[model samples]
Target: MKTMPVLNTIKKRLSAFALGVVDLVVRFKRTTEKMFLPWDKWVKPEGSIAREKLFSRFPRYLKEPAGSVRCGEGWYPLVWDLCTAIEAMEHLGMPRIGHFKAEERLGGLFVRVESGSFIVKELARDAEHRAAAICEECGEPGSLQLGHGFAKTLCQLHAAQRKPHKVKTVPIPENLATQRPKLLFLDTEFTDFDYPQLISIALVAESGESYYAELENGWSREGCSAFVVEKVLPQLTGGEFFQESGYAARRLREWLAGFGVPIRVVTDAPGYDWVLMLDLLHHELPPNLYPTPLNFYSESLPELRPLLKQAHDDACRDLSPHHALQDAEALREAWEVMKEHLHPAILRQYLKL
Candidate 1:
């Protein structure tokens, strides 16, 4: 009877310890789910039964229940197939996907996974390629359609609803061309907007001398954006224009040397085009080339934007736009048309004319 109280006290303590352990495990599981599952934060499609089934079947891969699927209903099959493939490989030492998000970008499916294996990546790539040909709105055969400032993969019926915007063209002002500093209008096509790697570059001088080259190597086709693959790659003329990167750089240097004067570089996208050009030159700018590049879309030249667009439209009427040489030539034409309309103060501020 004396030892019965001690036994009862020990049993109560043991029960409390067990309960505490269970509570800690529950908290840890919740924390892990919150940390690894990000689908709840993504933009999901409405009334997606496939998404619900995906989450239900792959609780280990997709832990979030609240968020909708980030893509259209047409892509549900692709996502489902991709997830099924990934699940099949989970036991084979592949890294579990901590976060997953799928969306349409540049008329193609772009799937982002925080962690995965080589096979997983390949599966994702295959799905994206398939998505490029399938309509995002409905499960129908489709092609990449280019609009005014957007691109989409749509079937004939859906594409009919989204017509390309027409831009008005204006006549070039021939008499008021500013002639000084020898401007070289530059343009470059690259792999993608997020991380651009130069595929081709072109420079069109004010005097009508032009240089254009396509890189023979140093860029992977897999890294190109859907927009680039559809719009830019088809325009490449791979005869004499294609050269190795080092040879292209050397040839570009030689071309700059031929000018025999300090050339001012101008581009609409100085951040990308100018940076890539500098990298191609090995960061050692030629003495004849100015250190700073002039941006045609600079904030100081707000009045020139409309005219520049019109001139580009006019120039591109006969020539294609995505081709680097043609784009550079279009930039030169825009500059020719814009200079005549710019106030003297603005011209002096940029060109010192």
Candidate 2:
């Protein structure tokens, strides 16, 4: 019986060794690491054995498409490395790529897959290191190099292109042409009066598309107004922002992207809330992707919310004031009523552009 058990163990070891030898043979035959595996789902790396161990570890791969990060179209070549890792993770039983993105940092990329399995974690960790070896510009073979003061992972071609190019800042045009602005009215609920810390924010576009999110962490009903505690707190509890500090912010940015730039945004508390909103998104968005920061024209549009609220209160139907989307809708309603009474040109004077 003992001999039989020992023989079975030897047989398993031999089988594993034979499979490893076959993987080696397959790799030896391949010309490029970028080539797809026999199963079209995988794009194996040059010297990586990670793919070989995938299926056995996680057996339930999601058939649905895992999403890709928007690192601009220029970096598409380098993106394939992580995409392949994402696919391998999928085959190993995680369906969705949680987040694969290039951070504001100079080198390497971030890989986050949803499965949270040990093998998937290993794959992501390995990909993070391998990214530095891939060319940042052309996606060819590359290595981290220091030329002047800064270091970047770039090929010889791109490195040459990085050679000091003349950059000029264009001055503001003498005659400024203006486009008829599309205004999305926005509102925010926040903690306290002194600092007016942000809690929940919401916006409704002229097109009826609306977004609302509560900043999840480092916030409380304490030190906030009773009206805010009563009105905003209940609505904020289940919001996606509470899921992550930045989730709601990203969703808002995505919603804004739907409306094209020179995005003229209006808020009730521009002095306080508007600044708070920008502060909330400072880390979440890049400079190029940053939405036009808006301020409430406190001088001209002072008491704008109160006037709108009073008008709303006089109406047959009343909207609960101070809730973000409701308040934005109130602004929309008030604007419609105000425009009917006065010309839009005059209204723009009050809006302060």
Candidate 3:
């Protein structure tokens, strides 16, 4: 019995040594594989390993032989685990994956797999749901952020580096300046879209004359939206231009009266800009100003829409946006670039000239 106990102890030691050797060999194989791989294929600039292993391990799923990974590196491990689980389903006699594609869509992971069971779809969805809380760039905890007309998933650190989408500048045509029917491009910065109370108003005439004013009272800061508070309020310069609502209205009327010619107000947002202007004027618009504001929108002239946007972007680059005066100037620039493309019939309908 004593000899048998000693023999059993020796056997246990040998088994432990064998397992250790196996683990060392596995680690060495991975290290050697990385050593032999191309420099670019081994690591990315962001410090994440390249997706070559994923492709090589699941060649049947990833059809693309060579290309950058479709999603962020933070989600790489999740993707690898998902793929492993999917391949394991083969033991259950599940159908083979005919096609597999994964990408980021609207700040979330989206995976499409052709020829799979309900369980496969559930797996993909679960992965996506989990990805919403995982930073796409560094795999840290993250959330979906929406701004500048796009959405992205990022952690606080990575989100700070994201910039708003830039609007491309469109050069104004050399001979496309309008000389007829005085146009006043208007813009207003208000408290909120739901119940907007004018914070400031501006009008830029085609002849270079302009009017701007900030309301000193009647609007509460509590009613302001996050966008208005951040982008609009900070741009305000409250000096001589700041006045009471009644005084501001009188100033605006007097300014409109100075323009002896019939003037048409042009604005991109008629519902907000035009309504706020009318409210400021106390429903008694100047005789020289047109009763109906001219709607400047993509639907008004589809062909000139891109040119108008480009011109506005160009103006915004020169002057800060969100300020009523600056926005009005931008609107005027957009009108000047796009007016030449307007049909005479459409012009007559709006200008009545």
Candidate 4:
């Protein structure tokens, strides 16, 4: 009879231990689900909790009768819940869930993971797309507010600060003691893979004066290399403004002369066009006119990488049917957009800026 009591006591203790192990396993599975699922899926589209939803808190994990559990410190639990709920709404394609760390999308704020579906993904993508989209190259929440100007997105810093763009007919300011020479906007057209050749050139002057220089059959390799020699030999060369009957060569030289003093020679691709001008005309353009750009290619500037996608999309929108002048204008517009968030004054001092 004493032996029977001992056996009974051991059986009861073993049953209790088995129940404890099962409880622990259940709690761990719940925590894992809470940490990974789309938090918003549990809620309605408007972000209000559904009537069918119920939550009960325990010492370790929150128990849900449905299929998942939620737990974490701060607003994390709530965020996780919202994300999970949103994912459920979107056919159970869960978001990539985790605590917020470094981000260029939300201005690095701690954003709760919601759904990572098409809609939410696109929004997130836009946030980090435009690397050089800001003047100072900042993003996410609490950073510069993005504003639109001339159909371009400007961050808080650069928006509404510049003088309105002047029309071609607008005259110079009357207060000028010295006459400012008119600037000419010039752009060249060439195929993507074309090496050394002249296709077409569009020259637009400040007074809205414009012209095109089209070669009879375009320049060949030898013709492009020694253009002034081979091409010029076959045509009449020099006068005041009408120098050389070959309209392209003479007009280019006249345009170059306008840079007697410091001036801004705006172009879409300064690296390429500027190089061509130097090679063809054999003249060194003034340095001040060509400000070094903050391109994504620069290893020193990493902030711009985060914004490239947005910048490219914006450029594409404004440059649907690509042309030399259109691309140039698009680039100029991009600069304006970037300047809105990143003030040139502050950005100039830092290498990364």
lDDT of candidate 1 at residue 293, scale 0 to 100: 77
Which candidate model has the greater lDDT, 1 or 4?
1
Model 4 C-alpha lDDT per residue in residues 1-353, reported as the tens digit of each score:
69998998986676556445434543554466568856454222332332224232221122322223321112233333333333333333344433322122222212323334443333233323332243222221122333121122234533322112212222323332143333344455432222423445544544454544444432322323243344332332113322222555556666555545433343444454544444444444343233232232234555754454366459659553234444444454554455466656634532221
* Residues forming the 10-long window of minimal summed lDDT in candidate 4: 161-170
Q: For model 4, give the RMSD to the true fold.
A: 25.3
Residue 199 of model 3 has an lDDT of: 92
Ten contiguous residues with the weakest lDDT in model 1: 164-173
Task: Compute the lDDT of residue 245 as modeled in candidate 4.
Answer: 26
lDDT of 4 at 130: 32
TM-score of 3: 0.47
| Model 3, residue 101: C-alpha shift (Å) | 65
Per TM-score, the best of the predicted structures is 1
In model 3, how large is the Cα lDDT of residue 24? 55
